[model samples]
Target chain A: MQLRQLSLRPFRNFARIDLEFAEGGAVIVGANGRGKSNILEAICYQSIGKSIRGARDHEAVPHGEGHFDIRGDWQQGQRRHPCRVFYGADDGKRVFLDEAPLPRVSDLVSHFQTVYFAPQDVALVLQFSAQRRRLLDIVLSQADAVYLKALQTYQRLLTQRNHFLRSLGHRGVDPTEREVWDAQLAKPGALLRHHRLLGLVEIMPDFARQYDVFSTGQETAGLLYADEVIESNPDEIPTRDQLEATFRQQLRDGFEKERHAGHTLNGPHRDGFVFTIDGEAADAFGSQGQQKSVLLSWKMAELRLLERRKGQQPLLLLDDVFSELDPIRSAHLIEMVEDFDQVILTAPRQPQESLGDRYARIDLE
Target chain B: MGPEPLEDLVVAFTRLPGIGRKTAQRLALYVLKSPPQEAESLAAAVRAARENIGHCTRCFHLTERGQELCHICRDPRRDTGMICVVEEASDALALERSELMRGTYHVLGGALSPLDGVGPEDLRIAELVERVREEGIREVILAHNASAEGEATAEYIHQRLDGMTQVSRLARGLPAGSDLDLADRTTLAHALQGRVQF
Candidate 1:
């Protein structure tokens, strides 16, 4: 699948812009804060119904505009499917696939697959555990609906459990109801962690391989899932039942701590991955180059994992990431990126390694 | 925004499921623009339905004229041994409209949603249990929805009727006329998992 064209209206810095792509993909070139990344955001947002930069729909709208519109025409050989997304400040978001309303965000994910890469994605590995979990989830959710449903179920139950906890502190409530919520939460929560573990297992080699390709260091690369529920070997994926039992015990044990905090604490939401370089935590010990390599390799693994799982090459969106890469890594990235079916690169100046006819350059003014 | 009666009508429309403020406003305006007889008849229909339509004592289906039992329950040809339980009256109505299921119906009123403080006692679950135990039900098809709450409610009901009668859930898979390639991942997974031997 290929994104044939992208049109953005009243979205962020772009007042109204439309660009028709040359076959493979296009390089959106412009200076900082010039709406180059916004174009990439629009494309990724339409496919995923989310902001890669964590901006809300209201914030994505232009200063004077109350809403934003993004439409991308996709072509798979002879078939042309137009995907459109609309976001209103007051009305929420809506997506249309070939002019039919898609009611669910998860349903929209695989319609146009994208892997968004930027400098701060290191934070995905080095900082917040949620971002690391999201790294695994975003890929898995797009490929398998079962995983997505399980994730949604787990999130809803977590919200309910947390709400119960918050209420438990202020007023007297039924302890029996907590059992029901916990029972429901355990099943899906275990499934989520199990999938994340399986996701790591499946992509660990690809992650290491990509790291070797991108990194200058000679130390061994590793991605370990630091689960709070169960002690899982970094190499082995635990079964759902095993994780479920542990999750239930942890939730039960957390009752006292959770009561005082007024929020449920131990679950997949608190889980994170620790990226390692030669048995050392990358975030704490690795150099700047190693950290950037960790993020790049992880994202690259994501692309490969999605392709292997879904049997379709996902579109790669490079959002001002080339600026952060060294000359060798940038060259390596451009080479590997060319192999993807589609890649939309956002950069201040055109990279030295150019795709002659395979790329179209758009300058955001 | 409108006069007292018009605003009241719109607000009334808004109280119904899926009817938003804008739709309610449009409906109210449509009623206002129509002939006086049309508005009067609409009001009469709502008032009459609310006053007359009540849950049947036997099947829990909505019955008009304050009937003791719904028409399906009163029908002698319908099977008495099989009871298909649903979460809402509308679900039973849908099954009846489909012209499937010769069995009687029992509306649980709503599923067991613990988050909302609803449990077995909140629904007509105990009544359902009693009916199955005393009525000598051979099989109880649990036709509850596939949501989390629905699953829990079905499980709860299943445990109650486990030894008393054979309880089964509704079949889930792809809808008819959907191609395998075009079907969503979830539906396709369900269809494949529940596939019959060819």
Candidate 2:
């Protein structure tokens, strides 16, 4: 996909602005708190149908402003299209794709594919399990819609199951109904676990290969998924039926514990992955430098995997993450990004040394 | 996007179900270009209908004037022993348009959805139970949408009225004009489960 222009009205601190980027992508340069990231955020919001910063519409709209509107002209292959997003206090949020109203915001999510390497993503290695799950979810959701749909269904089923369990203490509900819900949840939950494992399997090799080369072959890296649900073997990728059976068994086994806990005690929601460096858990002792190399390798692998799966290169948004990188890694990052269709990088200071004319400068004032 | 009056009309139209801003604008402009008398008649009709119409005492469908019951509830020809429960008045109207169902109706305000914070109390389940007990309705057909919440609502209603009345849900299968190949797996599965002998 190609983003030709971004128009923002009363969004965040930028009262109004329209930005057009070169095909090679642009560099947004400004001091801190000058709404530089806001430009990239507006683009990302249009792309993903939500704030990448996880902000609510009311919180994102400018103070005292009744509304905010963002519009974009984009091209996917040879097709040129326009999208508009409008949010107001009275009317609420609305989205249009190619002048046609989108039934749901989710309709636009599949249309706009972007790989965001925000500064915070670098800390994913050291962050909580929720953060790591989010990273995996974003990649997988963009790669395939089925995965996203299954993930959403699993989440809803989890909530409904929890609600049913909570009602058990008060109501004389049939145990059959609880079993039915458990059976329903197991399929999607198992599918999610399966897909996430597949996603990691696809990205791990590239991560390992990249890390070894990028770190000058000093340490070995592996991305291992820990199956908290049923404690299934990490190496085996179970078929949907197998996963469903396993999930059901776990649900049955944990029924007593879950009844006491007032929530589900086992499922993909509790499952998380860990990074390994030289046969040791990265979460506990990996140095910052090791974390950065792993993060870099993982992101690069994600970019390649997305391109391979989607059959189109996704736009890369680096939000000031390129700062403070050593010369070799910076050069490597620049080289890797040049392969993307478009790359938008935001930084407090302009990139120096060998950035060349490939990146257009958008000096935010 | 338009002049203040036009925008206001558009916004008002958009408040209606399934009407987006663009469609609302088109409808507003159509009204504007239409004959002045026609527009007045439209507004007057809407106002008069809203003023006179209230919910039916039993079914909660639309009623006119100071009538105590809707036409359907007042009619002696319709079967009062069985009530077709639907999610909305529009659904009840659709059933009436089909001319297939001879029974009266019950309209739940909406389906049960915990995610949306709609519970059993938020719906017309209590009214439905009262009607079933007082009217001695024999069967309750759950003619609701085939969504998760809709199914849950039907199940809850079933549980509430268990042994008091017979409960049946609307049949699920391929649509009237769709091909068998076009039917989804769930639909086919349902059709097979509910299949009848030739």
Candidate 3:
């Protein structure tokens, strides 16, 4: 899916803005802190019903306003569809497709699988494994509705289980009451790990290829599904039996500790994905430039994965990511957008000398 | 007569679950004027339970002694062949109030949902299957909610128990998508009685 036009009303720094794409791509160029990122964020919000920058609904609203709305005309299949997202004063958020209310955010993912890349994404390669895991999850969640559903269920159970644990010390409450939560936590917990592993498998080759292109064949990166629950064995991936046995054992051993901690501890929340280069952790050893290359490669791969799975090019949102890369890397990144139907790039200023007449420019002054 | 102590009492009360600042103030005012003996008794009751009560070893129920099974699981008269699987221990109490099913239960801890990254490996499903295999359960009754995650969970358990034992799910009487904990006792009991083979 590709976004044709985006209209924002009282969203972030943009009080009223309407911009159209050039069928291929459009670049929003302005100085730093001149609301370029805000425009890109609004477009991403319109597509996913959440900010790529992790802004709360209230924060997405104009500084002095209590509400914000984003309207987008997107092309999917052979037709152009209108999608809208609105947030209210009461912190309520709603999404509509063609004027009909969407049942869940996953519904929107199928039609508007926009990929967003930002400077912070460098953390995907240089920071904790959770960052890379999140990168994998965002891509996989958009590609598969089942994975999204599983993720939602796992989060709900995690909250409920934590709430129950906190209440264990309350008077008249039975400690054994937690057994029920333990049993309930396992099902979703296992599904999450399974899908995550599957996600890694699907993205590994893409990650490797993108890393090679960005790194100029200097490094070979691999995605590793890291977890304490997976026993040290000859198996590359844990079997269903091994997973179940480990889950049961962890539940048995962590019961008392969970009760004391007032939260469930042994599950996917504790799981991470390791990024390795030549059998060494890349995050700890990779230089800043190398980290940026790794993240860009992964994100570009994400765009390809979405395109391949959905049979359409996804909208690309580059939020001030160009300024962080060298001219050559920036040119390579811009070239990748040629395959996408629509691309929105946020930069400090138009690269007039490099881009020339290739991209339509919108000055976010 | 000073408001200082009264304010502290209100804050403490508000810290309790489900109690708001207004309710906390009202409760604190009532307690402040109550007899000293009654106040002392309340404190003693709280401490007495904390020092004594513990989880049952066999059934994992909260009890004074952790030696034997919980009352429900220990009762020989209850049906051992039928197990009502649930996500929380409070659900067992909710089920018991109706007195509809005499069968015992096996809590699965939680349902299958992967969004927050929870998977089958995080819960006690293997123990449940083990219980079924070891005890030779006649039927495994799944009482998970009807939400997407809940349905997926029930389906996963059903697949796990394929050819191992007869598995069933609570009927759709409880509504198309509703949590069991929120269902009324009558509706919960009806759903339990009308369970269909998976």
Evaluated with TM-score, which candidate comes out highest? 1
Candidate 1 vs candidate 2: which has greater lDDT?
1
Report, for every candidate in turn, its global Cα lDDT versus the true structure. 0.81, 0.80, 0.73
Ranking by TM-score: 1, 2, 3
Error at B118, model 1, angstroms:
2.4
lDDT (tens digit, per residue) of candidate 1 on B1-198: 668999999999999999999999999999999999998998899899999988889778888775798888899999999999999998998888889899999999998664675656778988998998799899999998978778767877776676898888887898878776777766777778888989
Give the higher-DockQ candidate: 1 or 3.
1
After TM-score superposition, the amount by which residue A256's alpha carbon in candidate 2 deviates from its true location, in angstroms, is 2.5
After the best TM-score superposition of candidate 1, give how far the Cα of residue A47 lies from its true spot, in angstroms: 2.6
TM-score result, candidate 1: 0.87
Per-candidate TM-score, chain A? 0.93, 0.92, 0.89
Stretches of model 1 off by over 4 angstroms after superposition? A160-187, A227-235, A241-266, A350-359, B57-59, B64-78, B177-182, B196-198
Ranking the candidates on DockQ from highest down gives 1, 2, 3
Candidate 2 achieves a global lDDT of: 0.80
* DockQ-based class of model 2: incorrect
Q: Model 2 chain A: which ten-residue window has the lowest total lDDT?
A: A227-236
State in Å the error of residue B84, model 3.
Answer: 12
Q: Rank the candidates by lDDT, best first.
A: 1, 2, 3
| DockQ-derived CAPRI band for the predicted complex in model 1 | acceptable
What lDDT score is found at residue A143 in candidate 3? 81
In model 2, the Cα lDDT at residue B132 comes to: 93
In candidate 1, the residue pairs with backbone N, CA or C atoms under 3 Å apart (3 or more residues apart, or in different chains) clash, namely: none
Residue range A198-310, candidate 3, lDDT tens digits: 55666668778878777755778776665332222334666655665677679779877987897878887777667777656678877777777777777877887788887
